[model samples]
Target: MTDIIETYLEDFGPALSGTISEHLEKSLGISAAAARKRVSRASGNIRRLGYVTFARKARFMYLENQFGSPLYWRKLVDALFSTNSAYGYAIAALIQREGFVPEWEFPIVCGAPIKQSRHLSPATIMQRLKEAGLLQTIQVNGLGDCICIVQSEEHYNSLAADTRVRLITENILLLAVKDWLRKLGIVSFDKVTIRSSTHAPKVGTFVWDLTAPSYLGCLIKTGKDKKVKPGFVAADVYLGDTITEPGSRPFINKCKTLRALRNVGPCMQIFIANRYEKEAFSLLKQNGIMPATPESLFGEDVAKGLSELTSVLHDAASHSLDPERFERLFAALGKIEGAANQLRGTLFEYIAAEVARKNYSSLVRMNQIYKNQSGKKAEADVVIITDNISVRFIECKGYSPRGIIPDTEVRRWLQHNVPVIYKAVKVHPDWQNLDIKFEFWTTGILSDEAIAMIKTAQVSTKATRYSLGFKLNQDVYDLCKSTKDKGLITAFEKHYLPPY
Candidate 1:
């Protein structure tokens, strides 16, 4: 595995070296020889272990498998800039700290301090940490950040007694449910929000509310002006696997927590691993609560995607030392990740092809970037032609986890370039007289404001005789799952979905 990854990195070494040298000269005023020496060491470390070994004696037996994959290693290397080994050492010390309490702040799991000086800035270091996936930024009432070191499911499950870790797990499950709901055509569904118990009791730990408006009864005196209420739905997710038996202190406390949540009108959900399912369910049932697996909440299609993702990860980790296995696993990862839109373009292409398979004969062309006679350049992510001579053009955007597709970007694309692109395609002699349709696809949640802008844009575009439509993260996932491909279904059942 190390050899395979080394070969992969060899293709990028010159680029990496150039980046490191420039950062060192600009950030630290380092000499060229010193920078080259540092780069050499970093490169050697990556080639040997696929990650930096910060601690001289500390062992990472549990994390060995994670280092097997080139992607994970690339993330680590990318996290460290030239002459920033101190930041790496600081992270290592934090990981080594005993009885670590997770916190949502810079220097999240503090142990040995990374000295603050003119040469090293916390802001830049923190940003690098986030880019490396060693940290994650989240929004609650305000922006907050937290450590995100566990790269795989196996590593996450190995942690003990960390409420924050448990919360992260629960949030992932909730996100899956939110995605599933979206796929089911619930466009009004809002993204789930995570709130700490310390902040607000009414909000619970996780909340999902729809934004559609509802009419309420009119005021008593006038009985004319009707009150308006916003649509809302909430769920309180409890990680209950740690409870050993019923009637115990922890079990009772959890029940009390659920009772409190019920008083606040949100449904209660408990997630337990299979090992503790019988006992956990018995205790919850006695309290009028039923425990649910992640699969049961999100359904089979989601389970399959989740399973395929993890299986690829686990396979890469388990075979990190074998070149043959590494190559095979790398190829598999590419296919899964490609279909999953790791490269951003694949997600759009996959959706376009799938839609064509269902309705059109086949995809005509993908990733067509063109300039009109007016010199306006516009790129369509995908293009397809149906048997009836209908032509479809798609634009795709892939956003990271917890990211939002903003209204401003969508507005610019819809108002400025889309019209010109339509004109350019219409002028093509071969495409003349063909009906044209436009679609926008994104793997991120679209804000209500953005959706409103899209709708308004759709109205204007329709006036020009072009049809326009949009699909967000949930829509894409639902469409893929509905295909019911046998291999995907098996992967989901065997790997992704929780064992019932």
Candidate 2:
């Protein structure tokens, strides 16, 4: 199931929806788009079908059909054809210039690299070619032998003249290389590597991510052999015989974040962990600013930084004889730091994650329970358990005055000591308040007092300043109390409640 979903994601990033997508699965063996794409394709009205409805809810859209109807399929096919007018234009240009369409597979067989424009896919282009009936497949004995399906066509007719194909060919090659170059964030080809490959169009491109505005890659393998490696000769002055051939690339202008913060105020940082994450953190540290999530990306430092900053701000405002002075200073500092954040975009993630976590359900809502284990020691902040048909975890947050989840607690959970990270981030009034949620999940039981306790707990101003955990307002407390007292679970389908 996961594989099918991932396959869909790989094929279509966004423009996926509705029932015609289903037609593709049934007719083309491609599952996972909405049934409506076929409709959108046909009528240009995209919402005709999809799991966005109740029938397909159980199946993730990416794993579902494109659309549920056939009329929609025709629409989609027509849309694809109408959209490729540019391809036709280019082909027509080439044909006119050369005075011929060049035996259907002539260009490909004679050796030409094929890649789609940035907004399109090679597969989509191939599909268009199939629709135009202009493609002629052949059995090539070498590297680029995709799938052997020999072609036989008596006569071919194209809407445009001969010049389209030639012009399109040139454009395709240039665009493929340009897109590849963008991946490496480079603008100049002078400092590039181009090598031949055993494949039909043998050429690969590379560049630095930081050095270039965008990272694009392309390899045009044109022929078969031991003489080629789909390799390229780059003008990386420091480049050795190979791209990754240590010392072949630039010194990766990696400056630490801490170091970059030299001129800035205190700040927080989280290291997402992989090599890239570490490199990012290193860059921040190098800049001389506070990198919050240390130890691990979400380590003690995050909580500490928040706590420290909160305290510093609140303390200064509270203790100073002239509070106005501190307020003015703080406001000025906030502007300066906000500007830095605008430039970096890292600090916003913490706040964004909090917002997203609340609005996002699914795997994210599972944050309600986190799991961990302990062999010989007790864990702090959480607990875990499992049974025949269910698994449950409890997280206890110690949101005292400076209210924030400690990194030690995160480490504890990673060590199987704590149950989850969110619970630890919340500043609930009573520990027992949440204990009942765990009981409800595991035993299918809920205690009125426990329900009331959690529901009644109010959000602390301190905790709100940090993590965006739900505030357990009065309405929730009452709702839980009423639900528990009425034994709504027992009522099941017959249950009904007043619109409080």
Candidate 3:
């Protein structure tokens, strides 16, 4: 009976479970329940051999050997297109052309909000397609909700996490540039249109990071006759650590395409990043690409803020993430966008992780989320742990070099974050028989009250499972110097060290 069911299913690709069962019952003259049992058994066997299932209108077809197949996703998307051309094409264009589109903007891309009252609204169309498992929405940090195509759990997970982070990072840079442009009186926010991958036209075959059209010249405008200028402005941004030899050729090629497009009219081409190789820099200047850094473009303060935010975000992309915390981090990121000062604390966390890596010989993780048996959740900034040996949790405060650590901040770390983390560590099986250390590292002076609180907390925890310690600005600098890592030393001096 199972062999018969498998043979029947092999002939039909991706049929609903009920449809398969109904066919079995009618063809074999068996009861519905008996037929369903045989169908279930057959599917379970196929699933073990690289097949996958989905739930749409019902338990969707179990595809044979689709699980580990390189061509499976394309086949699945093609099937979706066969079912509904409009929604299918939208999904394909979003993934292939644009990469990903925020949900709100997606409707506009699809030529939505049709005028006639008789037809279904654009929102309704999207909602219906989502209900049918043709579309999926993943909430990105800072960027809000974004659209991707997937009908099953496996496919969703396969979409890389760094890809989403990269999208959010790019959008943040664009927003910053837009704000900077507005402040300079070059253009108002309303006049400027921030283009996305699919929304913006490609220059040759390259999709630019920034694309805008000019309404008037930078320094000239006729009051009586307002003539629209025929010109283009575009920028390409590199977010990698540094643009080196291997990566330089492709970038230069793309810049050449933009240069060729200049024949249509006057065009402004810009390149933005923190660091570039000497050769890459020369090539950019030779090709007429204006090379700009955050500091060069937006000044020292804004540049420092952008550098801190991107640094923390790059580190965050590697950790095992909790959905709630991920959302919070992104929300915090949005806040940091407006006020660069907000990134100091999060930025310090990454710096502290680097210090922990230099001092301790163990597995070090940042922004680790933990939950105890009673469902109490806690987060650790930097945790260094080796099974059955030791666990160190470090909380960081990234205030100004001469700033004072608040008494309330000290009180909470001792009173709240410490207790929760202790309980969380106790519940972990591998953390058994380990000595624990809890430390506060800050690039600021401690107030007298805050110092007393730390001393008291240390005395109280002396007999306990964990020990307590604190490192001020000078102490942190000394530890960093001990590491003898030139890059680490330079970063610490720039961000944390004080001038005498």
RMSD of each: 18.8, 27.7, 13.9
Q: Which candidate is the best by TM-score?
A: 3
lDDT of each: 0.44, 0.27, 0.59
| Count of backbone collisions in candidate 2 | 116
What tens-digit string does per-residue lDDT give for candidate 3 at 372-427?
Answer: 66755455677888666799888888876987888898898888788888888887
Sort order, lDDT high to low: 3, 1, 2
What lDDT tens digits, residue by residue, belong to model 2 across residues 364-406? 2111222123213222211222222222233333121122334
Estimate TM-scores for all models: 0.31, 0.15, 0.48
Model 2 misplaced regions, further than 4 Å? 1-74, 78-152, 157-189, 192-500
Q: Judged by lDDT against the true structure, how good is candidate 3?
A: 0.59
- Greater-lDDT candidate between 1 and 2: 1
